[model samples]
Target chain A: MTASVPAIINEFLTGSFSTIINVLKVLIPLMILIEFLSVYHVMEKLSKKLTFVTKVLGFSPSAVLPLLVTVVMGVTYGAGTLMEMNEKEPLEKKDFILIAIFFFICHGIIETTAIWGTVGANVIIISAGRLMLAGAITMAAARLPFFKP
Target chain B: MDPVVQIIKTGFIKAIKTTLMLMKVVLPIYALVVIIKYSPVMPFLERAFEPAMRIFNLPGDAVVPLITGLFTDEYGAIAAASQFDFTAAELTTVAMIGLVCHSLPVEYALSRKIGLPAGKIVIYRILAAVVVGLIISRLGGVLL
Candidate 1:
């Protein structure tokens, strides 16, 4: 029984270590990219272009950056961006809900596109569909009287 | 540098930085999946996901990706998709459905943070997922 316990413990340690290592591999590069984008202000231009769509979805124009990033990056990255922006300029609770709804519906574009593409699907269709649906849902939710902040 | 050149240079650097950060997070997650697949824990996880798979008309093995995507993130689901032999329609349907209802844990936590009822958030998302999944599957068939 003692021998079995050691083996089990060893297996658990190895499994967890590898998991952490793997996640780090993906996370570090993603962070570097995000930092660069923020420093260079490329997202500013993109946000301007996305403003029209976001406004139609019942969100403020400022929400475009976080919304686009959330879909292109991942949830944590998206939320991190929002938190950072919030520090500089706080958003209304309604705006936060809109951003959250958008991110919850879609994130991690490269991974999703690649997976679907690998399976012979049209990446554009999948991407567009997600964006539209997420936008629509957020807009509808925002319009509900009960959801007003 | 000229103003145009300066703009381009800065943009390029920023793009590269963003890409690298994303790659860092994605790569480790992939490695973790590889380890899980090799470990004895995978079978139990596979079993745990079977019921969820049934709701989507997928096999027991498909449960792993769906559950992974729902809990951790979609990258895990994408990795799971890599192991399947899905048609174009199937792929689109699955991706759409996943986009609608993926990342339950994160969403749930976020909802709780916002003072939304955890149960309500989960139930609404799950219901939305099912509705979207069925609609997308049908639409995929029609489109493809």
Candidate 2:
């Protein structure tokens, strides 16, 4: 079944508008929080506690916030924090690749888990599978012959 | 300016800029996907994937939601998948694939903006989704 011509245009306009609103609502506050954290060195302190993640993912402490944001919020939101951090201190290419690999597989954890659950999906299995798959792959990748980070 | 005020001002400016950057890329992709979702392309895709879906232990008709989920969004895919009597295993398989690969055209563009290895990540995602689907389908008895 196909949508009629008018229906297509209608959905596009409304969909894009709502998407922008949703993005702005979350991003503005998150950006402010990030700036505040940076000025106060909050993320630095926080990242220190996550040495395990940094060691496992082979990324620096600075990568923790963006990586966590991507995991919880979604990619577009994560990209904002990532761009700012990378500008201040460029992450290595291998680290970026690993982050990307992890994000693509397992971002939007809370949201996808709930949404997918509505279709009779097992929430626990899906989330756990994604986390483990992404973690395992990224950890192995950090040790790859080609990517030295 | 007060220190707090300065932080707020700087944050808002950067947020607006990044939001604009994402909107520019996302809007066009959204429109194109909207059009494509309504085209004959969907029917062709449905027919093409029917036989292949057996590998995932999904019904042949499950391709409707699989393609919808890949091309559009997870919500649309769920709506389509709801039309079928999907067992927990089948649902998990489809949902896993959806989580990994939905909204591809828009997401791929956004990832490019962040200087990620977009193409490589996306390729891996597709392959991984297929693999996850297959694995989950085999674990049906354990699923709720």
Candidate 3:
């Protein structure tokens, strides 16, 4: 009955709507998994495993929890963790900057990787590239005099 | 209130919230792409972007999604990108860059709470995306 709308608009609606459907497929389970893991305190367990890596990278011990939360979640959630940590424990200026840099390049691994995967990108390859890139960049920043000293 | 039920409820709520959030960006941009595809402006804009996109092994039209992904969010980027027929390598390159750089306004603002300048974060993230896109586009043939 709404024939007044142009055919191109219909095409746009159908095309965009289809993507939304595809997005729902990935987003629902991903959210459930995130909630499940958080409820079970899996992030805490993961953070413990990550402490050694943080120490080796020369990040302070206080950085671990927020780091884990941010890397697994997105920048928004990561920033929340950072804010909370800053108020409570307060990392050094260098530590905060380095963490910000690392997170900027790589955050929301599972959620984003899956979203891209829906578009037929290589899941394994993209995640690996991000992790590797984040590590290399963060390490380089850590070694720089401004971040290190 | 079993823990499993609670988890599912919370997850479902978050998913719905995300869906709404994504739709806000994805819908208008996707419609815009459709309009652009049929409009006279597409050719001119595509030609303008052709040279820059070439370095990423993508078409001029790819700039629409690339710019959207950088300035807005990836949800819109993917929606706009769906209109075009991109090679596997091109899509991979786009995904890699989007993965690195997205939602700059909100993220940069949030990141400022940590004391780093938002301007520097945006500039650096764009740099990271460029570095990533260059490498991914080159390796796209074998990697994908």
**Best prediction by DockQ:** 3
How would the candidate models be sorted by DockQ, starting from the highest? 3, 2, 1
The candidates score, on chain A by TM-score, as follows 0.68, 0.67, 0.89
After superposing candidate 2, which stretches have Cα over 4 Å from the reference?
A1-47, B1-48
Q: Rate residue B69 of model 3 by lDDT.
A: 87
Best by the TM-score measure = 3
Q: Can you rank all candidates by lDDT, best first?
A: 3, 2, 1
Per-residue lDDT, model 3, residue B126, is 91
Q: Write the per-residue lDDT of candidate 3 for residues B67-131, one digit (tens) a residue.
A: 88878888888887787888777888888988898888877777676667889989998999999
- Candidate 1 lDDT over residue span A49-143, tens digit each: 77788668887777788777778766666767777787898777788777776666667765456545644567887888777777778889889
Worst 10 residues of 2 chain A by lDDT: A18-27
| Candidate 3, chain B, TM-score (2 decimals) | 0.92
| Ranking of candidates on TM-score, top first | 3, 2, 1
Please provide TM-scores, in order, for all candidate models, with all chains considered together.
0.66, 0.69, 0.94
Clashing pairs in 3: none
DockQ of each: 0.22, 0.47, 0.59
RMSD of each: 6.9, 6.3, 2.6
